[model samples]
Target: MTSIQVADQTFVAAAPELAADVVGDRASWRRWWPDLRLEVVEDRGAQGVRWKVSGPLTGTMEIWCEAVLDGFVLHYFLHAEPVAAPPAEPRELTRVLADSNKALRVAGKVMSFEVKDRLERGRAVGAPATARSGTA
Candidate 1:
């Protein structure tokens, strides 16, 4: 089996709890990494999560969050092999790598921008904000 590996890192400008809510929440996870069909194999609260990836590439992926001085650092790791036969040409390999890299970048953007916005705005991503105690 041909081996494949990918690593990406991004920082979310929010607390660990907020970052986790955006990244770890199943709904957001699906929205962020729509290309990947992943199931949680391990859930490490305050640390991150591990998932079994399916689809074109079959492998294991993990996303972990670490508290940093400014915010939270997101670490993404993927190690897997193609589900089908290996790419026949150098071009094919390049194409596969490009696609995967694009996906990673998109994920990073979603986490850093979309997720951060939702969490920092005082509401969970996709969850409605609750009424203030006294405000109408």
Candidate 2:
């Protein structure tokens, strides 16, 4: 019964804990999802957070930070349905769903890229990378 679902992963050249800090910012949440209200369902610290979304949509959203080569992969997931009644006609429903899907998709990408741009300022593109975990 989900009308819109966005699953995105963006790699950032920064520590997981650092990325978590950026993702956990309350002000940024309001800025990124002004139309939606999010209440924390779970706080995973350096990993990320799960939120119960309301307002424009009703469902669950999460950002999972997975440690990767020299950085972390920020996974954004938004599973929601339109708050208003969906179109009755098939064609209208398709159009509405597509538009909503695209909008949410773009929003997720923009948010992740902003984080990447902010934290990976000087990282060289195409550089060979390896995950930094445990002790050497």
Candidate 3:
């Protein structure tokens, strides 16, 4: 099984509510990635939780997540067989994967910083900060 592992540290503005929301519905992940479906395969309170995701990717991913009242961290392992051979050259595949990883890392950092900033603003103003920060 070809494997891709990704780790993301996310900060939620409403940590408590967000944690509850995430832990509440693993299936709801479909709403985020329309091409993917996630099902909770295991739930271990405090220690961690794991889920299986399959769809267009045609793979089983085990997402081990650790939750805290403020935010949660996720380690995802994607084990999938390519649906089709790359339309591009093999060298291109490496480049594509590198680009994808870079993009995801950038996105994760932006998202985490945004959420943290929003939480800070919310605390300062006593209201939720849902406004775009222009930076992102």
| Candidate lDDT (C-alpha), each | 0.69, 0.84, 0.48
Which sections of candidate 2 miss by over 4 Å?
A: 126-136
Best by TM-score: 2
Candidate 2 vs 3: which has more lDDT = 2
Q: TM-score winner between 1 and 3, please give it.
A: 1
Relative to the unseen true structure, what is the C-alpha lDDT of residue 31 in candidate 2, on a scale of 0 to 100? 78
Number of backbone-clashing residue pairs for each candidate, in the order shown: 0, 1, 0
Task: Put down candidate 2 lDDT per residue, 1-136, tens digits, no spaces.
Answer: 6889899998887767677667888899887888999999998987999999999799999999998867789999999988998889999999999998898888889889988887666656875342234422
- What lDDT tens digits, residue by residue, belong to model 1 across residues 41-84? 99886578899988877888888888775467778777877676
* lDDT of prediction 1: 0.69
User: Candidate 2 versus the native: TM-score?
Assistant: 0.88
**Cα error of candidate 1 at position 120, Å:** 2.7
Q: What is the overall TM-score of model 1 with all chains considered together?
A: 0.70
Candidates sorted on TM-score, descending: 2, 1, 3
Runs of candidate 3 exceeding 4 Å displacement: 1-3, 12-18, 26-28, 44-49, 60-81, 99-122, 125-136
True lDDT of residue 8, candidate 1 = 73
Backbone clashes in model 3, listed as residue pairs: none
lDDT at 34, model 2: 85
